[model samples]
Structures are given as structure tokens and as C-alpha cells.
Target: MVQRFTISLDAELAATLDGYMVKRGASNRSEAIRDLIRNALTLNHTDKSNNCVAVVSYVYDHHERQLGSRLIKHHHEHHDLAVSTLHVHIDHHHCLEMTVLRGPGEAVRRLAEATLAERGVQFGHVNLIPLKEHGGHHQHDDGANHVHQRPAL
Candidate 1:
């Protein structure tokens, strides 16, 4: 069942939303609004699921008072979840790193929060995928018959 509601917006905000809808090729206002709400909910996590993968990207000062070292150490501490990391030197004073993590949703969320909370870190973004845990360890007659699932949903 679907419930309908009416929302009133000012002229400027409505125009801006309409512009976004037109630029993005969204089918309708409902679709665009649903996507925007989904994105906001994705970032504002509140679930404690154990089957999820998340990509945590952030920018920071690489030489900001041992921050880089701390970040590296943190990754090392959770090596199982640290799937891969991409580092880029944006400029003389800025560094960007995208870290892909897989494990419990809570663990990944905590790691992202911790990294983002560090001093000198900025513009942190995390994308999470919730997955169904079908008992990672499965038995099979053939070793190549098993298929793994993607991180986070």
C-alpha cells in the first residue's frame, strides 16, 4: 500500500528541485525525491547488521601532525575489512584516500566515523551495501561451485 501526501515548497526551492530533476533525467518528482531520501538515509546509518560492505572516501592533510600514520595504523588494525585503499596526492597540501571496507555493517560504520573524526580529515563520504549472510562457510562437492556476494547493499 502507498500513502500520498502533499508538501509545499517555496518558489526557489521548487525551481531548484525541478532543475535537478530535469538535469538528472529523473522520471518524476516521486522518483527523484525517493532517490534523495535514500541517499540521505544511506549516509545516516542506524542499523547494526553484520553483513555489509562500505566504501569510505576521505581527504586530509597527509602531513598533519601524524594523522597519516594514525590512519594507516587504524587500517592495519582492521585488515580483514580493509579490502583496498587508493591514495592520491591532490596537491602539495591535500591528500585523498578511498578505502573499501567489508565486514559487519557496524564495524565498517565505526571505522568510517573514526577516520572521519580525525583531525585534518575533510569531505568524508561512505557508501554501504547490506548483504544477506548465508553462512559464509558452505559445503560443496566441487570447490569451484560457490559464489560470493557483493559487499553492502
Candidate 2:
């Protein structure tokens, strides 16, 4: 199903939207608007969901005293919520890490906040997408059998 509608924006706002669409590589104004609406709605809905998957990213100085060990311990504290982690060496003194987390939304948010609150951590960000729990069996075209337990929005 699709819905068609019209909207009016002031000249300055319209021009700003156009520039944003171009910068975001949206290809068309309609698609850009749709993406913006979807993102806003998703953020609102995800906040109310009980379960979600999140990507937590942060940068820190590798030279910070015991920072790496503290981070590892923090992740260990929420081991069940952790899906995976990627570590990157940004430079001799800095490192960037992104961790994928899945579990209760509140727990995930708490862990992300605790990590970001640690001394020396900077540029921390967490993007969480709500997940819908489901129960079903699935079979792939390649004859692989699987179960559908969690679906993300």
C-alpha cells in the first residue's frame, strides 16, 4: 500500500531540505522525506520497545590508564547483551571500538551510558533498533534449516 500527500515548507526550509537530500545521496526529495519520516518514527517506536539491538561506538586514548581493561570488564558485565565487537587502531595513541549489543532496551542503554561515562572515552554513540520477537521455522533456498526467533524493526 502507498499513500500520496502534499506538504508545504517555507522557502528557506525547502532549500535546506534540498541541500540535505543532496548531501545524503537520497537521489530524490520524496525519498529523502520518506527516509526522514521513517527514521523519526523508528526512533520514537524503538524507545518504547522492550528488546532492541544496538550499535555502540566510542573512541578513546589507548594510553589512558587501565581504560582498555575497564572497557573489557564493562562488556563482561553485560556479556549476555553483547553480540560482537570490532576494535580499530586509529593511531598510536587512539583506538575506536564498535560493539553490537542485543537484549532488553533499558539494559542496553544503561551499558552504553556506563561505557560512555568512563574517563577518556569520547565521541560515544549508540543507535538502537527495536526488535520484535517471533517464533517460526524457516528454510532457505539452499536447503538450510533455521528458526526465526528475533526480528528487527
Candidate 3:
């Protein structure tokens, strides 16, 4: 069921919201507002124990005194949480690494923080999306079973 409510916004704020709607490709103000509210609520209400997927990305100097080895060891230490990693050579001295992590929110956050805290890491960011398992597990025609996870709306 959907509920409707009315809100009053200042002219300036309304104009800003219009611009935001255009930039975000929202079809209407209601759609834009719904997306904004959902994002705010998700960020504020997520719990540490909730299952989530995160993308942790950072740039670092490859020559930073054993930093490459240390990063590999760190990921290995949390192997269960790591889903995949993409490494890019930014230049002769710098490299970009993006790792996809899935597990409890707390564990994902801790790994992201540890990676970003490395001495020469820079431009670090973590995008965490809380998820809920759907329909537990199901078997396919091939008899493979798996669980589906979707963002917690």
C-alpha cells in the first residue's frame, strides 16, 4: 500500500529540487523525493549486523614500502568477506584497487577502513548497500541452489 502526504518547500528549495530531479533523471518530483528519502533512511537506519555488499576503492603508490604485500595479506585474512577485486595501473608509480565485499555490515566496514588506512592509500571511498536475502534458497533446473540478495528497500 502507498500513502500520500503533502509537504511545503520554500521556492528556492523547490527550484533546487527541480534541478536535482533533472540531474538524477527522475520523472517527477515525487519520484525524486522518494529516492532521496529512501537513501536517507537507509543510511540512518542500517544496523551493523545487517548483511551488506560494499565496494571499497582506493589509489595508492605501488612503491610504498611493502604496502602491496600488506594489502594482499589483509584481503586474504578476510577472504570470506571479499567477493572480487579489480586492479588498475594508474601510472608507473600509482595503482587503483577496487574490491567488492559482502558480509555483515560491521565486517565490511572494518575491511574498508583497514584498506584505506594503509600508509600511501589515497582517494579512498566505500559504498555500502545493506541487503536482505530473498526467498532463502531455491534450486534451479540444473540442481544448483543459491540465495538471492537484494538491497533493503
Candidate 4:
């Protein structure tokens, strides 16, 4: 079911929304507003107990003493939270790393912060999306094959 509500916005705000709608390729104000609301709500989520998946990306100087080893050690310390990592050599001295993590929101955030706080880390960002609703899961005949239903929009 969908509920409708009316909102009042100043002319400047309305124009800004229109501009954003064009930039983001939204079909109309309704679609753009819905997306904006969803994004804002997701960002405001503060429940530490929530289960979530996150991508933590950072760029650093690989030449920094023991930085690589330290990052590895940190990941090892929280092995359960990490799903996988992709590393790229950006240049002679710099490397980019993106770690996919899944676990409690608190743990994921802590690990991301620790990794980003490393001495050589230059640019870092963590994007987290909570798994609020779990769709039904199914097991295949092989037992190794598992599938999950898609979340409803």
C-alpha cells in the first residue's frame, strides 16, 4: 500500500530538487523524492546490532613501512567480518584496496575505521547497506548451491 502526503518547499528548494532530478535522471519529483528519502534514512541508520554488508575502500602508500602487513593483520583479527578484498596498484608508490565486509554494523564500522586510520592510508570511505529484511532462502540438490529471494523495493 502507498500513502500520499503533501509537503511545502520554498522556491529555491524546489528548483534545487528539479535540478537534482535532471542530473540524476529521475523521471519525476516523486521518484527523485523517494530515492532521496531512502538514501537519507539509510544514512541515518544507527542501530549497531543491525546486520549489514559494507564496502571499505582506501588508497595508501604501499611503500610505507609495514603498512601492508598491518592491514593484513587487522583483517585477520576480524576475519569473520571480511568477505573478500580487491587490491590494485594505483602507481609506483600507491595502492588502492577495497574490502567487502559483512557482519554486525558495529563491528563492520570499527574495522573500517581502524583500517582507514592506518598511518599510510590517504583516502578512505565505507559504504554500508543494512540487511533489514531477509527474503526466504533455498538450498539446491547439491546442498552447496543456495539462493536468496530478492528484497522488495
How well does each candidate superpose onto the true structure, as a TM-score?
A: 0.78, 0.84, 0.80, 0.80
The stretch of ten residues in a row with the least summed lDDT in candidate 3 is 144-153
TM-score of 1: 0.78
Runs in model 3 with CA error above 4 Å? Answer: 44-46, 136-153
Ranking of all predicted structures according to TM-score, beginning with the best and ending with the worst: 2, 3, 4, 1
Candidate 2: segments with Cα more than 4 A from true spot: 44-49
Q: Per-residue lDDT of 23-99 in model 1, one digit per residue for the tens?
A: 88998888788888877876676478656778888999877999999999999999988989999999999999999
Writing each residue's lDDT as its tens digit, candidate 4 over 1-153 gives 999999999999999999999999999999999989988887666578788888999999999999999999999999999889999999999999999988877888889899999999999988878786566666677786555653322
- Model 3 Cα lDDT, one tens digit per residue, 1-153: 999999999999999999999999999999999989888875553477688888899999999999999999999999999889999999999999999998888888889889999898967988878887556777989999987554442
Among all windows of 10 consecutive residues in model 4, the one with the lowest summed lDDT is 144-153
True lDDT of residue 101, candidate 2: 91
Cα-lDDT of candidate 3: 0.87
Question: Least accurate stretch of 10 residues (summed lDDT) in model 1?
Answer: 144-153
lDDT tens readout by residue for model 2, 1-153:
999899999999999999999999999989999989877865554354578888999999989999999999998988998888899999999999999998888888888789889999977988877777775787789999988666645
